[model samples]
Target chain A: MHHRLDALLPLAGAILFVMLWWLLALSGVIDPVLMPAPQDAAVALWKGFADGTLTHDFWQTVWRTVLSFVIATAIGVPLGIALGSSSRVYAAVEFVIDFFRSTPASALFPMFLVIFGVGEKTKIAVAAFGAALVILFNVAYGVMNAKKTRQAAAHVMGAGRLRIMVDVTLWESLPQTFVGMRSGISLALVIVIVAEMFIGSTDGLGQRVINAQMVFDMPLMYAAIFAAGALGYGLNLLFLVIERRFVHWGGK
Target chain B: MTSHSPGSPHITIRGLTKAFAGVPLYDGFNLDFARGRITSIFGPNGCGKSTLINMIAGLMPMDGGQVLFDGKTLRETVIGYVFQNYRDALFPWKRAIDNIAYPLVRAGMDRAAIDARVDELVTSFDIGFDLKRYPYELSGGQQQLVSIMRALAPRPEVLFLDEPFSALDYEMTLSMRDKLQEVFHATGVTMILVSHDLEEAVYLADHVLMLTRRPTRIAEVIDFGAPRPRTSATLSEPGFVRAKAHALDVFQREVRRAP
Candidate 1:
């Protein structure tokens, strides 16, 4: 009973907040154009669904985010592993990674637009760059903290460097890698949406929100904002499930 | 069985020296393990027993020395080592059976053969209660036994054990000793054990190597010519008692001399 209640607490809080917003709107304390009532937001979301506008934008956002995440994992995981395993390489690249991390992803948006132009490619580049920075450091930290004795034991057991990585280093760092990917997913979602919103785009959820705001369609804009939040929460839960399945030892 | 193979010693160490932070641990250390015999190293705490074993295991680099195995450099030889801390010895994430099969995975054995060997070892070691259980779930004694089986599964020429039974209770330790004797008798592999417990050392070793304190060097090498199939009766033998007394004296002297 207690566990179920704990799980439901967040949903309960969200419902209460929506109800409070409805009451505030009903009292005429805020104008409809400025603060849409909960029902108006829901109606606007439902109308978008019927017209296929919401579905198209949602799929566009999903594809771009997924592609960006894959690109980040492909480049970031290997670079992180290499830097982590070799002391000389890590020392050489440490300053560069730190600088990239400190520079905001938004600052690179204009550069990406100039180089790649305002398209899916530009948005992906921005998202991948931002997401890769987060995962690379995590991978380095995981490799540095790997057990020496385990590696030595594998060596004595006739494992070469590659085998040592498969049996020991990579396997041991797997949990940390999963954690890094989890965090990267969240960061990528944030950057991908922002990239889609600011950089020229016409079909993504971010573009829809910007379009609504420009036309003074407050209900549509609020609905899109809520949709983005929902999508982020859903992706986080999905990543958590993946983490649990792969690393059963690390309990939820 | 009385003499080593008609060649150089199975393992030969000469002028082995190791230092940490300007403090010398082993200086001009020399030792050898004869082929097909169990040798135990006994010493007072901080006498570099672990340091010597770690060097032999190739876990650490020696300050100045050479280690020869069967007249070959250590880089050219195969060795198996069992750490005293079972917590460190076994990977907590792996199941007991997989842990036992680790050596085979490293050796590039076929999956079927590895599975067969792992099954045999699991049965031989009686690790059935929780073959699928992780190391952290098992007791200290259970984990230690699993560690020993993991080290032995590879069937290395020379096995290095660093006080693997120290953490066990009295009864568990005795049973583990019995299991070890059974394994050694069955395999006939050379063994070297490093320990501080005199009785435990004499109980298991054919020859006990004693060491002095830091800047450590061998104090003495006591040979127990007791016949094989060692048991409780071996401990009561006159020579065993005398050797234990002598080991105690060296241990006490080292204790007094160490800062």
Candidate 2:
């Protein structure tokens, strides 16, 4: 009975959150124009999908997010492994990696725009750049921290350096690599959405939300915000599922 | 294959030197491991019992040393090592069977031959648990058994074990000890075990190697030639009791001799 109740507890919290939002909307303490009723947002969501505008915007954002993530992963995993293999090499460039990682992707938008000239290339490049650094740091960490005993076991078994890396080090780094990939994908999505809002994007949830607010289409703006929220939650969940399936021995 | 009879030196260590931050742990250390006999290394705390074995096994780098297995370098001779932490020793990602097969794979043996060798090890171990299960799925004792299997997979001439049972409970330790003895008698593989527990050290060893504190030297090398498959009854035997007491007296003396 306790287990069943625990499962339903999350549902209860969601319902309570919706109730609080509805109550605040009815109270009218804030202007109705800024805060639409919950039903108005839901109705706008349905109508936007039915009219196919939201569907187009949703796919556009997904395409950009996935493209950048793929690019980031391609560059990150190998580079991370190469850097992490030797302690001396990683130490030399550690500060440079840390500095770029700490700086916000948004702050570098104008520089990217200067390079790529204010188009889709610029947005994707910026998102991929932010995501790649996150992935590189995590993958390198995983490789560097690969268990010493495990490596020694392989070496004692007559394995050469190349074989040890492929057989043991690669497998050892997987759990951490997955951690990096998940965070990288999430960061890519956030940057993609923010880029769409300011980089002159014509279609995407970010562009739709901003355009709705400019014309004071309150219900549409709320709907776009909710869509973005759902997308973020869904992507995180997807990566988590993938991580469990592949890295089954991860935390063990 | 060299010599199954005990007392023949299978490995020679000469002038082994190692230090931690300039406080010498071993200097000009020399030792011999008898062919086809169990040797348990015992010493005072921080005396480098594990360190000595690791250096001989080529797991740790020695500042200066020469180690030879039948006059062959580490790369030329096949060796197996069972680490104290079985959880860290066994590859969790691989199934129990695959973990046992890993050494064979590393040796570049064909797939068919690898399967045959792994099957032989499985039967010898009398394993009833599913070999397809991952390491984490098994009990602690079972995991350690898998580690032992993997070590023996390459059919190494000399097997090095670093406190193999320290993590296990008393009950598990007893059965693992029996299994090790069974394997030793059946195959006559040279076994080197490093243990802190004196009784455990003497129980499984044909020779117990006692060492002094750092800048370590051999305190004594006592040989207990009691017969194979020693059981709980062996613990109370006169020879076993005398050996244990002798080892304890030497151990206590060395502990007090510390600066």
Candidate 3:
């Protein structure tokens, strides 16, 4: 009972914040145009679905994030695993990796626009660049954290470098890689939306938000924000499902 | 194949030496393991017992000296290791059968031969209940049992066990020891076991090799003349008690005398 109550405490604060927002809007302390009422936000969500505007934007954001995630994983996982498995490679390249990781991925958005134009390609490139650092660091961590005993056992059992990776290193590093991908997905969503707002031609959830704000459509803008949150949450759920299936024997 | 007489040694170590960080663990260590017999190595903590076993198994580099099998080096023989801690030894992501088949697979054996060996082992070891279960699902003792079977499955000429039964309960340890003896007898494979427990050494080994503390060298070799099919009854034999007492005395004396 206490465990459950402790879990509910965070939700209680969220509920209180919503109640305050409703009261502020009703009392005119906050203008309805600036912050739509709860009922108004609901009506906007229903209308978005009824008219198919939300579906189009959501799918656009989904494809961009998916494409970025795939590209980042393809390039980052192997490179990270290779470097992290060797102390020499890690020492040589760690400084450069750290430099890129600390620098803001969005700071290069203008350069991306110049190189690829204001198209889906530009948005995806930005998202991939934004997500790659997380994937790389996580894969490195996963490889480095492989148990010494397992590695020794594999070598003594006559496993060469390739066989070691195939039989031992890959599966051992999977759980951590999945966890890193989970965090990377969150960053992917944010980057996808931000990229669209900054350098997009048409049709993305972020573009929808920017478009609504351009015309002073308060309810529509709020609807887009809620949809972004839902998309991020749904992606997180999908990652969890994948992790549970592949890493069923983890933690034991 | 080099043949030994009924009482000749199968494994020989001469002037074995190893050092870590400029500190010597073994300086001119020497011992011999008789053919077709279980030799228990007894020593106190940090006496390089595991290090010695590793050198014998070719798992670690040696600073000096030679380890011979059947009067020839490991170049002419096969060696297997049953690691001390099963929790960290077995591959957690692999099923029991897969783990047993790993070495054979790496050896480039035929698929049919590998499958047959895997089936034979899983059945003989009675790990069928967990043929598909990952290492994480098995208990520590069960994992150790599986590791032992896996090590033996490759049919190596000499098997080195480093505290293999230390993690098991008393009952499980006794039962597993019996099983191991059966396997050893059936295959006629030479066995070397490094252990800390005097009772265990007395129970399983035909000869117990005792070592001194760090910079360890062979202190003495105690021979247990107890017959095969060792049991709790063997523990009460006169030679068994004498061997255990002599081995313990050497260990306690050396551990105190060193530092």
TM-scores for all predictions:
0.88, 0.98, 0.91
Candidate 3 off by > 4 Å = A1-28, B5-7, B71-76, B126-128
Q: Which 10-residue window in model 3 chain A sums to the lowest lDDT?
A: A147-156
Error of 3 at A105 (Å): 1.5
Give the chain B TM-score for each candidate. 0.91, 0.98, 0.92
Candidate 3: true contacts recovered, fraction: 0.55
What's the lDDT for residue A177 in model 2?
A: 96
Candidate number with greatest lDDT: 2
Which DockQ values do the candidates obtain, in the order shown? 0.34, 0.84, 0.61
lDDT of model 2 at position A34: 93
- Write candidate 3's Cα lDDT for B194-256 as tens digits: 887889987888888887778787788888878778888888888788888888888889888
Candidate whose TM-score is highest: 2
lDDT string, candidate 1, A180-252, tens digits: 8888878888888887788878888888899999999989998888888888889889988987777775421
Misplaced by over 4 Å in model 1 are A1-7, A250-252, B1-9, B91-94, B130-140, B166-174, B196-199, B223-245
Per-residue C-alpha lDDT of model 2 across residues B21-128, encoded as one tens digit per residue: 999999999999999999999999999998888888888899998999988888788888999998887899999999999999878899999999998998898987
Q: Tell me the whole-model lDDT of each prediction, alpha carbons only.
A: 0.82, 0.92, 0.83
Model 1 vs. true fold: TM: 0.88
